[model samples]
Target: MAFEYAPAPESRSIVDIKPSYGLFIDGEFVDGHGSAFKSINPATEETLAEIAEADAADVDKAVKAARRAFRTWSRMPGKERSKYLYRIARIIQERSRELAVLESIDNGKPIKESRDVDVPIVAAHFFYYAGWADKLEYAGLGANPQPLGVAGQVIPWNFPLLMLAWKVAPALACGNTVVLKPAETTPLTALLFAEICQQADLPAGVVNIVTGAGDTGQAVVSHPDVDKVAFTGSTGVGKAIARAIAGSDKKATLELGGKAANIVFDDAAIDQAVEGIVGGIFFNQGHVCCAGSRLLVQESVADEVMAKLKRRMGTLRVGDPLDKNTDIGAINSAEQLARIRALAEIGEDEGAERWAPPCELPSAGFWFPPTVFTGVSQAHRIARDEVFGPVLSVLTFRTPSEAIEKANNTPYGLSAGVWTEKGSRILHMANELRAGVVWANTFNKFDPASPFGGYKESGYGREGGRQGLSAYLKAGA
Candidate 1:
């Protein structure tokens, strides 16, 4: 069937983004001292908005506003804070469709995902954390379990709204004012979220948004008033942020890159394994931190598995992001597409055979075909690096031990998926795997309650569940 191009049913063009540049500080939009930069739609190359580039001064101003807000926000009773978070959650629900469309327009993610997965999960994060506001005493984060004051969060372009919720919800729930910088490629939803803050009547400076590239993020990390810094992005940038904050007393949590492994055993439910492998790499066009970029299959079942996987991949619909039926959308930005392509070339140069389903990609938009690399070795760049695209490197293993060895042979330990029929084997692998979020018989399964984060260079701390609250809590009885 040809890929469809139906408009998103709930989409409306109610918001106007004038050719303006500004900072969202103290509950209002104001000009940035820095020069203007264009934020283009990856799917069409349209300049959707010209966002204000944040310089060091803007970052400092935003941090100051957040520090001021923390005085009252951090001191407010837990019950009162809970109400505020709940209000934000309700407002997110009401304006979700608008936010979803904007996310697709700016980020080139399919409307189906932005609507079904991202938007709902973003709101659910707030709702789930909202209930925890007054209940932190029982969350097991030590004595008083108080706020960590002003937190500066830097999020990437992949899941703009969801990432914001992941960082902002917990901070607000624990009574921390936030200064968040959404990625330059996709700042629409975050800017839209600034409006949602007003709708929720969230206090001025409780949530301030600064928009820009790397230099601006550096400013946020180096700012003195930011007590804690949380970031979700590339390992390279995470390293820079870590280095920038090394001398300061400020605490930092990084949710960096990954080259996750999806291991399939011979006895696994082949159908479910096929689905898991497909979903693992294809979800959000594989622009996911925890994307299963590597697939390890038992040699006994490798041929059958690859055949089924090819058939499954052939059915995915990739095109316009606003289309309700799009399975894979355009790459988020030109820079990301270039990165994906460059790494794929490196895969070829490093001696791996690439295979992609015959599908038509958008001509004007930034697109990379969903690719699979065969004849892969543990040392192949495709197998080792975080490609951050819908590219899979397939490697066959003769034994369970070999599979584990190949899976762990990476600098990242963010997520992994295991497929097998044996419960003992599942438990054994789960215990052995070093990744933060492990999925058996499934891949890319996320929840507001499940704790999610990585080990090693893939970064530290957990995002959801009780562990999430710990990041925001101060030890005082």
Candidate 2:
């Protein structure tokens, strides 16, 4: 007999989400010229709050504010900036519970993930960049690298607050001011972060949050005053931003889409690989840009691995983002759910075998069962396209070279995983893989100190570590 678990829901009362939120520009909350939209909780389809949408004019206002603040912010001593970054990190830690709860409510991610993974890493990023703020002279860029005045940054919805940290922390540490736009679906946490900036007494215009859809983001990217542009989203949008800034002098770094391959060798421990596979594709409901959606198992161990993976998938609890025990949460929005469903149907129509564990989902929310498609071929759209949900496609490879060939066949080279106990095999596979970050025995792991980005369509430039600081600074200044 199996033991049934009771729902362990995190309380939402801790986060005081206002009835409506306005744009955060020049250290104050103000109304936007664009129309407002309601932020809905994906888990219940409940309207959470009214969010102000920023238009082109509002984005220009933000850029102007950042440009104005850049004069003083750039001149401020790095030691002073370090103090502010450190304070922000501490405050993120202090209010972590509130932020975690709010993140789950607004973003439809599991509470445990928001609490343990997202919020903690968000704070770590701030802390890591804070240390570098005063010591950038040794960053190896130059003896005196200078700030690239106002940055225009746009982050995606998948990892809302965390992505903001990836863009904002390093920019601020390098003495650049920024106007950031969080994704339309998940703008709440970024708005709350603006409050944290105020609490840290970060100077006016040092960081601005504009809430809106694509038009506002375009405005920020095309603004004459923004000296730098940083974006994390779909590959299509990344390309658009690249084109928009092509003839200009703006520095840009884009972290885009991925269809990572997780290769499992026959010599690998099947049980351990099963867990890693689950975490790789199912963590955050497979919304991760580097999710190991493609599983390349050695033919000898394919059956055993699939059996184990299926059994593990059966144990995943799906429902209620606020539930501590839930492994799979709601899709971030209705449109995203439609995309997932459409791709899944295409997989079926293309003759791939689809299987989902017996799991009951919430009736009202946007949800998808954890799905696995076996008999998937390289030509199948499901194998090539990013499902961006809790979906996995399984394929088989006989030899190490074949595994490498299959893995590198995709347009994306963001990340990949190799599972094996042999140290030499791991090193050899790592060298051959085209991915930017290759894990020997793990997947979906990230650290603030390590640099991350991708090759090919996965987008260019790094986002973390010392290398990331260069994107926000002028060389040899």
| TM-score for all models, in order of appearance | 0.97, 0.99
Model 2 collision count: 0
Residue-wise C-alpha lDDT for candidate 1, range 44-94, written one tens digit per residue = 898887899889988888888998999999889889999988999999898
lDDT per residue for candidate 2 within 1-477, as digits (tens), equals 555899899988899989999999999999999999999999999999999999998998898899899999999999999999999999999999999999999999999999999999999999999999989898887889899899999999999999999999999999999999999999999999999999999999999999999999999999988899999999999999999999999999999999999999999988989999999999999999999999999999999999999989999999999989999999999999999999999999999999999988879989999999999999999999999999999999999999999999999999999999999999999899999999878888999999999999999999999989889888775
Which residue runs of candidate 2 sit more than 4 Å off their true CA positions? none
Q: For each candidate, what is the lDDT? A: 0.89, 0.95
31 Cα displacement, candidate 1 (Å): 0.7
What lDDT is obtained when candidate 1 is compared to the true structure? 0.89
Residue 107 lDDT in model 2?
94
